[model samples]
Target: MPRRCATRNDLMKPGYVYIMTNKNNTTLYVGVTSDLERRVKEHKSKKDPKSFTARYNLNKLVYHEAHQMIGDAIAREKQLKAGNRAKKMALIESINPEWQDLIIGDE
Candidate 1:
């Protein structure tokens, strides 16, 4: 399973990546999708018929990446998801130390 991201023109394409944060911002979940904004909205609104995000209330957008192909994005996502929380935090810090939700552009 893979995900998508929202980065300007890359919004509806595969190979996109994203990271979500909890209200306290302690819990982080990395994902990749072709439609980051739409996907995030789904989680935020619990639109999906069945979803892990809705169950955990993990709707805060923290980070994201857009790619030209789904395979590349999936590979990167798998790598990040397989790592520990420390590694994931490091990855986010390296690119977004502020930990702000990049998904703000849509809202």
Candidate 2:
């Protein structure tokens, strides 16, 4: 069978940079994904029990930002990871002062 060509819509899928945290907000996990909902669900489900986020119980979707390109999202994720906890907390508080779980009503 002939391979299908890429469409504009396929190329425009958005990417996301998200932060997950434990209940106490002591641990922050920054990640980038093209499918934010699915990725968050996997983290909440402890899909990889041995992973750092899962091990630290960091399932709360505290903060997220959308990007038009995957590269931008990845770069933002890297910046967040390299920054200190104070910087990360400031970013989170700017959008989610209470650190409410963004996925709460989706289920």
TM-score of each: 0.76, 0.84
For residues 1-107, write the lDDT of model 2, one tens digit per residue. Answer: 69686466655677899999999999999998889999999999888999998899998999999999777787788989999999999999999999999887332
User: Which window of ten consecutive residues has the lowest lDDT sum in model 2?
Assistant: 5-14
Residues 1-107, candidate 1: write the lDDT tens digits.
Answer: 57655465553356678888877777777888767778888777877647677666777777777778777787889988899998888877888888876665433
lDDT of each: 0.75, 0.88
For TM-score, the strongest prediction is: 2
Off by over 4 Å in 1: 1-13, 105-107
Against the true structure, candidate 2 reaches a TM-score of: 0.84
Off by over 4 Å in 2: 1-13, 105-107
lDDT value, candidate 1, whole model: 0.75
